[model samples]
Target chain A: MRAAMKDGARGASMTPRGIAAPVLGGWSAASEGVPANVRTISLQAVKIRMRSVGNIQKITKAMKMVAASRLKGAQTKCEKSRAMVNPFVRLLGDTPGAETEQTLVVPVSSDKGLCGGINTAVVKYSQVLNAMTPGVTYNVIGDKARAQLTRMMPQQINNVIVDTTKQPLTFATASAIADQVVARNAPKTHIVYNRFASAISFKPSVATLMSNEELEKAAEEGVNEFDSYEIEGPDRSEFLLDLSEFKAGVMMYNAMLENNTSELGSRMQSMENSSKNASEMLAKLTLLYNRTRQAAITTELIEIISGASSLESKE
Target chain B: MSRAMMRLARRVVGKNASVPVRGASTQSRASIETFMKNFEQHKTSPTMEHPATSSTFASTPVTEDVKGTPEKMKLNFYLPHDAPFDKTEVDMVLVPATTGDFGVLPGHVPTVSQLRPGVVSVHVSDKDVQRYFVSGGFCFVHADSTTDICAVEAVPVEQLDPEAVKKGLAEHQAKFANAKDDVEKAHAQIGIDCCNAMVSAIEGK
Candidate 1:
C-alpha cells in the first residue's frame, strides 16, 4: 500500500519525464532539479508526454476536490469525538503511574496510505517507546502501523488489529479493542497517535491509561480529588471497577477517532499539494514542449533558406 | 446522525418511494397497517414480558470567563458523537445513579456516581424540562456546580420507539440466558438494563 501510494503521489511528475529519457531516474532530479536535457528530446515525443502529464494533472485536481469535501464531514465527526475526553483523566489527574513492569503500547493509524507521514509518525513513536520502556508488548491498531511495527519488533507484538480503515470508528469497535487490551492485564497502556490539530497539522501524542487495579490502588491511596467527592451509589468499589473499565474504552475510542480524522485531513492536504505540484510540473513541461517545437520549426526554416540560396549561386 | 433522525430519514424515503410506486393506494396501506398491528400482538409473548424502567451534556462554557454563581448549575452532557448540552445552566438535573435515583440541584455537593440505565431529566426552567434516556455511564457533579454526564448512548426519551425497545429486550434476555462466560453475561446485562429502562421511559412507569 505504501509503495502504491508513493507511486501515485510522484505520478505524472515522473512518468512523463521517464518517457523523455527511458533510463533516467531520481524522478525529480532531471525534471525539476536541473532544467533537464528535455530540450534535446524530439518534439513529437515531448508532445505525447505533455498530453499524458496534462491528464495526470487533471486527475490529481479532481482527487483534491473530492478529498476536500470528504474532509469537511470527517472534520465534524472528529470535532464531536473530541468531547469524549476520558472522564477518569479529569477526576483522577493525580493517579500514579503503573506499579507493574509490563507496558502495552497501542499505535493507532489506518490501513490505507497517501495520508502523508501520520502513520509513519505513529509507528516511529511506538518504536521510540519500545526503546524507552522494557518489557513492552504492542496492541497495535490499523494495518499500516501494525505491518510496520511487526516488521520492526516482531517478537514484541501482542496483538495486530487491521481493517480499521474500512469504516468509521464506533463505540462498539473501540470497546472491543479496549476489552482485549484490558484482558492482557498490562498495568500501563500507552495509546500513540497523531492528534488532529488542524487541516494541515497534527501533534504526535501518547495518552497513558492505568489498569483497573492501578486505578483502584490510586483511589485507595486517596491522592485524587475523586477521593474527596461524596459517593452516593452502590458499594463504591463496584462502581470504581466499572468506571475504570469504561473510561479505558472511551479513551481508546477517542484516540481512534482522532487518528481517523487526522488521516482524512492529512490525505486532503497531501492531495492538494500533489495537485499543485502536478500543475507546476505541467506548466514547465508545456513550456519545454512548446520551446522545443518552435526550435525544431526554426531549424527547418533556416536549412531550407540556406539550401535555396546556395543552389541559386551555383547556377 | 441521531438515532431518531436516522430512523426518520429512512422512513421518509421509504414513504416517498411507496407513494410514487403505488399512487393513491390508501386501502392497501390501511390493510397492511392492520396486519402489522395483529402481528405485533401475536409476537408479544406473555412469558417474556418485562417491566419498564426509567434516565448533561455541554453548555457554552458559561464558567469559562467567570466563576459560576451558586444560584445556577452548569450541566455538561456529552454522548460519544454528540453534545446535547454544553455548559447550559439548569435548575436541577435528575440522574439514575446505580445507587438509586439522585437529583443534583444548584449548590449541590460534589459527587461522582455510576449511572444506571434510566431517565435523566434536566429542567432548564420551572416549566420546561428536557428528558433523555441514557445507557449506563457516569455522572460527575463537581463542587463548582458544573456537572458533566458522559453516557455511552443517550437518546431523547421522546424519540425512542417502543417496538425497538421490546425487540432489544428480548435479544438481551436471550443473550443473558445463553452466555457461557462472565464477560458475555455482564455485557448482556447492560443491554437488558438499557432496553428495560427505555421500555419504562416509554410506558411512563
Candidate 2:
C-alpha cells in the first residue's frame, strides 16, 4: 500500500514532464545528463513536495487541537454519568444470563479517518464477536466500521446509523438509537465500543443490553440479587423492564461518549506523530535537494575548467 | 433536603473516583467505605430519623398506628437524558402508576411502581407543590423511604402550554382518523392519549 501510494505521487509529478517533453526537448536533454535543467527540475519537485508536506503538517496540528478540546468535553461527560449507573453495573454483574436465539451487535465507531486504528480495532473486535457467536446481527453507528463490517460479514449488516459526530453527543442521540434497537426487539444486544482507558490507551469492550422478556426470564431464574436493599413499588416486573430500557439508553450514551473520547485521543495522538513525521521528511528532502544542487554546480564548474584546458592544449 | 441530596451526589462522585480500574485515589475508597458503613447501619435499624444528622432528629409523638409523623423522603427524579430532580427532598410525591394513581409518603412500604403518562405532583414544601408531566418510567420506593423516579421524559406542568396540547391533540386525532392500517392507528392513538394526558396535567384536573 505504501509503495502504491508513493508511485501515485511520483506519477502525479511526472505528468508535466510527460506532456511537455516532446515540445521542449527536455526529455532528450535529461537523457544526455544535462545537469542544469535536471537539477532545476529535481529542486522544483522537492520544494513543491516540502510545501505540500508542510501544509499537511498544519492540518494535522489543527486536528490535534480540535480532538484535544473535544476529548476534554467527552471525558467530563463520561465522568459525570458513570456514577448514576454504578449500582446497575454491580447488579448486572450478579444477574444470570439467559441466551437468546438472536443477538444484536451495536458497533460504536466514528466516521472520520486519520484516527489510527480506532475504527479498525472496533471492526476487528466485532468480527471476533461474530465468530464467537454465530447468527449475530450488526447495528453499526459509524460509516467506517459499517463499511469494514459489511465487507467482513455482509449478511449480518442489519442497520447502519448515519454519522452524527459533527454535532456533540447528546442523550437524544442515544434515545433515537435505543428506539431503533427496541424496534428490532432483539432479546440480546451487545454494545461493542472502545473503552477510554486513558489519553494514550483504549480497550475495545462489550456491554450487554437485555430486553424486557429476557430480564423477566432472568428474574424468574431468581438469583434474588437485590438482597442488600429493600425495593418498594407496584409492578416490579414492569419497573425492571423500564429500568432496563433506561439503562440501555444510558449505556449507549455512555459508550458513544467514551468512543468519541477515544477517537479524539487517537486522532490527536496520531496527528501529532504524523506532523512530526511530515516535518522530518521535509527536512530530509531539503538536505537532499541542497546536496544534489551543490553536486550539479560542481559538475558544471569542472566541465567548464576542463573545456578551457583542452582548448589551450589544442592551441 | 437539598443537603441530603448533595450527600448522595457526593457519595456517587466519591464512588466513581474510587473505582480502581480508573487508577483513582484509594483515599476516596476509605471515605466511601465509611459512608457505606453508615448506610448499612441505617438500613439495619430502619429508624425514623438519621443519626448522622441530628438537626432533623426531633421526636415525633405518634399516637395512632395508621398515621405516623409526616417525615420527608428524598425524591431523586431522573430522566434518561437528564436528572430533573437530583435527589431533591420532598414531603410527599403523587405518581400516576399503571397499577393505579398512588401517593407515596415517608415510611411508605418498599415498592416499585411503573409510572404512566400523567402528572407527578411533588410536594416539595408545605407551600410549594411542583407538578410535572412524566412520560412513562419507573418509581422505586426504598425501604429507607428514599424515593427514586426514573422517567423517560418529563416537562414541568407549567411548561406544557395549553395551546400546544390542543394543537397536538387535533393533529393526533386527524392522524388517527386518516390512518390506513391498524399499526398507524395505534401509533396515532398513543399520541392522542399522551396529548390528552398533557392537557389534563396542564389544567391541574
Candidate 3:
C-alpha cells in the first residue's frame, strides 16, 4: 500500500515533466529542419542554460564551504587521535605484511559521493593488491567501497559493512569493523585506505594489521619488534593478545579517521574545482550570448539599410 | 660491603633505577624516603604550620633536586576533539592506572597501562599543577621520558559540577530500576557508576 501510495505521488508529480517532454522533443526535432531559425531560439536556450549553470555554481560553492568547515573539524579530530597510534606505528612501522596463503583486504572509505575518487582510489588499490597476492578476500567498510568492489569483484568480497560514516566516526565504530576482520582469522590483513596528506592532497595507502600469531611468525621470519617494546606485566602472552587486539583497533581507528579526513579534503577540493568549472562555463556562455545578440542586431541594421537603399533606388 | 647490600636490595625491587612496583613504594630514593618520613612525623606533631599544604600531599608531587634526575616528563593528554596538553613539559605526572594512581617521573621505564576514571595530575612544580578527570583511557610511559594519556574523554576537575553529578546519579539509579532489558540496565549502570565516580572524585578533594 505504501509503495502504491509513493508511486501515485510520483505519478501525480510527473505531469510537469510529461508536459515538458514533447515541447523539448518538438523543439529539437524542428531545429534539425529549420537551420536558419537557430539564432532566434538559441538566445532563449543560452539564457536558460546560463540560469541552470548559475544555480549549479551556487550549489557547488555552498557545498565547498560546508566541506571546508567539516574539513577543519575532521583535521583536528584526526590530529588528536594520532597520539594513541604513535607507539603502535613505532612498533609496526609501515611495512607490508609477510606473504601468507590467506589474506584479508579491508578497504576503508566514506559512504558519501562527490569526493573526487577517494573511494575509487581505495578500490583500485585493493584490486591491485588482491590481484598480486594469492588467496585474498575482501571485507569492506563504507557503502562506497562495497558497491564498487561488489561490482568489480563480486566473488572476492567476504563481508560488506555499510553506513560507517552515517554517524560521527569513532573508536567504537572502527573497533566493530576491526573485530570483523579479526573474526575472519586471516593470516595477513591489509587495510586499504586514503591517507590524509594535506588539505589539498591525499594518497592511497595500505596499513598492515597483524594478529599476535602473525606477529610471532613474523618475528621468527625476521626482526622481532615486540622485544624492543618493554611491556612490564606478568602475563606476557595475555598482554600480547590484548595488545594485538587493541593494536589492530587503534590502527583501524587511525586509518578510518585518516580516510575520513581525506574524503572531506577530496570533497572540498573537488567541489572547488567544480565551482571553478561552472564559473568558466558561465563566462563562455555569456560571451557566446553577447556575440550572438550583437550579430543579430548587426544583421537587423544591415537589413534595414539595404531595404531603405532599395526603396530609394526604386523612388 | 655497603654497595653490595645496596645492589642486593635494588635487585629485589627492580633493575636499573626502574621500580617494579608503583612510585609510592620505591624506598631506594633517600629524597622520597625523607619526604614521606617528614610527612609522617608532621602528621603527629602539634605545631603544624600549614595544615592545608600537608593534607594534599598524596596528589601533589614533591620534587627534590636530585642530580641527573632531570625529572622533566612531557605530557601529551589527548581527547578525541582536542589536545590541550600537547607535549606539555612538567616535573611529574600522576597517572590513574587500573591498578592505582602512580606517579611517572623522568627516566621512568616504559609501560602501557589501562587507565581508570580518576584524576590525572600533572605537576609543573610544587606550586603549579594541572589536574584532569580522565574518563578511562590508556596511559603510556615511554622510555624517552614522555607520558601520553589518550582518554576517551577528559575535562578539567574544576569544570565538573557537583550538583549535576548528584542529579545525574539519582536519574541513573531511577533508570536502572526502570530498565527492562539487560542492555538498558547495563547502560544505566554505567551512567550510575560514572556519576558515582564523579561524586567521589569531587568529594575526595
- Top-scoring candidate (TM-score): 1
DockQ of 2: 0.07
Question: How would the candidate models be sorted by DockQ, starting from the highest?
Answer: 1, 2, 3
Q: For each candidate in the order shown, give its overall lDDT on alpha carbons.
A: 0.71, 0.67, 0.69
How displaced is residue A23 in candidate 3, in Å? 19
Better of 1 and 3 by DockQ: 1
Better of 1 and 3 by TM-score: 1
Best by lDDT: 1
lDDT of 1 by residue, A41-96 (tens): 45556666556656665666676677678778777877787675634555654221
A82-178 per-residue lDDT for model 3 (tens digits):
6666545444333343556888998988887877988987877677676556898999989899888888889989898888777888777777788
TM-score of chain A of 3: 0.82
Of 2 and 3, which scores higher on lDDT?
A: 3
Among all windows of 10 consecutive residues in model 2 chain B, the one with the lowest summed lDDT is B49-58
TM-score of each: 0.77, 0.68, 0.71
Which runs of model 1 end up more than 4 angstroms from their true locations? Answer: A1-41, A94-100, A234-237, B1-69, B170-190
Worst 10 residues of 1 chain B by lDDT: B48-57
